[model samples]
Target: MKATTLITVLLGTGSLLGLAGCADPVPEEPVPAPIPSVTPAPMPPKTPLQASHALFDETNLRTSNTVPTGGAAFLAGLEAAGFAADTLETTTDLTSVGLKAPSIQFAALVDSTCLIGQYGPGDTGYRSVIVAPLVTGGCLVGESHR
Candidate 1:
């Protein structure tokens, strides 16, 4: 009876160990899909002043009557158009260029590029918008009346 009891206990223990081995492996925690990296959209390219220059080059520069009137207005327009306000320079005295009207000359340095604009009493709108290399200060693209 003792021998039979011992054999039964051993068989039971062996069966439990074998069952444990056969149990399904803890399903490997489903590897979470690698979170994709998010990248920001690139900014749109800056438009060159080609259109403004073309308008300036036209025979009748005053095609538009909606130009800013005074030096202050012109400077404000430049600031609104993404120009650096600190780099802006404006002067009413056109004596150096012999412009008779109470003209306003404005220049702004943007991205190491110089943009010059001229507006005055007689002109319908901005008379010129010139884009030039930084070397040429400002107002070099349009007629200076000199």
Candidate 2:
């Protein structure tokens, strides 16, 4: 009887050990971090004169199709933008030699800068508009007409 009881106890212990070894292990999952959001700043619009100056620079005046041709309207626009009008001259002298149409030269001085614009006769529009720093009196090249 004692042998039988010892045998039964041993069998019970072996079964428990086998069951533990055959069980599968569960792995723990990792947590993810949250991301942050950001916003950009706004910019201001350019003034009339500033816009005009930018257009002139971008187009180089010679190749631009947007610049206004010479007339009362052109002078008025410049004057309204705080530019002091000089004089309007009608001549082909200031224009490129290839263009036979007489051009009207429009000149203005604003904030120590001289703006010279040349427009062809009729509806031919602008030939060029040059911006230069003012010297002792005015722009060295675009100031006078001869």
Candidate 3:
């Protein structure tokens, strides 16, 4: 063919070979190490009186069914939670004039301390507290059921 065409073909072939030899080699990626799993420790057991707080919440949540309403339900919850009837006390369901009492106060005497709780209607809600025994050596005074 022509001289210029032959020279162009030779130059193009030489450039391709030169570029191939000048390229750098690719590097390989390193493998990662494995991770270890960790476990948590267990907690110690609680006393019967200390467990009463949790039982009270459980009883309060399921009111009006499974157990009778008002003070008896709370007493049942306390009894089921390891309290004996002799150790329990509560306010009367009715006032001396025969009107319904607004709320009921109950207590479980553990040694000198009283684990006291007051349960009422939806508007009044419920509360539990740790209180000292009264002067007469009991929790409730005035009119009470036991």
Best by lDDT: 3
Cα shift from native, residue 42, model 1 (Å): 22
TM-score of each: 0.39, 0.35, 0.58
What TM-score does prediction 1 earn? 0.39
lDDT of 2 by residue, 1-146 (tens): 99999999999999999999999877668666676665666667886557656644333343324344434445555555544456322233434656443666555554455556666645775655546655644543543432
How many clashes (backbone N, Cα, C below 3 Å) per candidate? 0, 0, 0
lDDT of each: 0.58, 0.53, 0.74
Q: Residue 72 lDDT in model 2? A: 49
* Index of the highest-TM-score prediction: 3
Cα lDDT tens digits for candidate 1, 103-144: 656676655565666655543455554455544554444443
Model 3 lDDT-worst window of ten: 59-68
Stretches of candidate 2 above 4 Å error? 1-44, 47-77, 80-82, 86-101, 122-124, 127-130, 134-136, 140-146
Indicate the residue-level lDDT of 36 in model 1. Answer: 92
